[model samples]
Target: MTGPVVRKCPLCGKPRSAEHAPFCSTRCKDRDLMRWLDDGYALPGPPALDEEEGKA
Candidate 1:
């Protein structure tokens, strides 16, 4: 059987249409940009340690 259809927009969790296969619409795409600009999203990474860097 075919894998579960994964045709939803990653930014807005809406079904992706042919015109905007990865984003429901241009608006949703812009919304994702705004979120980035406003720091609504975050990246997972290791925390900085002063001791490791011989700073403390």
Candidate 2:
């Protein structure tokens, strides 16, 4: 088999830690969560209309 591939952290580009898996540390994890809560990330698609609004 080949050597194990090292995965870099998504936030800081540092080597990933076992405890945090994809994230390098607690701070990065919290930062990702905050981004989600603050709407820093968004799904790509057309706006979705409510059922009643669609009928109108």
- Candidate closest to the true structure, highest TM-score: 2
TM-score, prediction 1: 0.57
lDDT tens per residue, model 2, 1-56: 99999999999999999999799999999999999999999999998999989994
Clashes of 1: 0
lDDT values for all models: 0.83, 0.94
* Candidate 2: regions farther than 4 A off: 48-56
Off by over 4 Å in 1: 1-6, 47-56
Candidate 1, position 22, lDDT: 74
lDDT, candidate 2, at 55: 100
Candidate 1 on 10-51: residue-level lDDT in tens?
Answer: 976888877865789989888888999998999999875788
Which one is best on lDDT?
Answer: 2
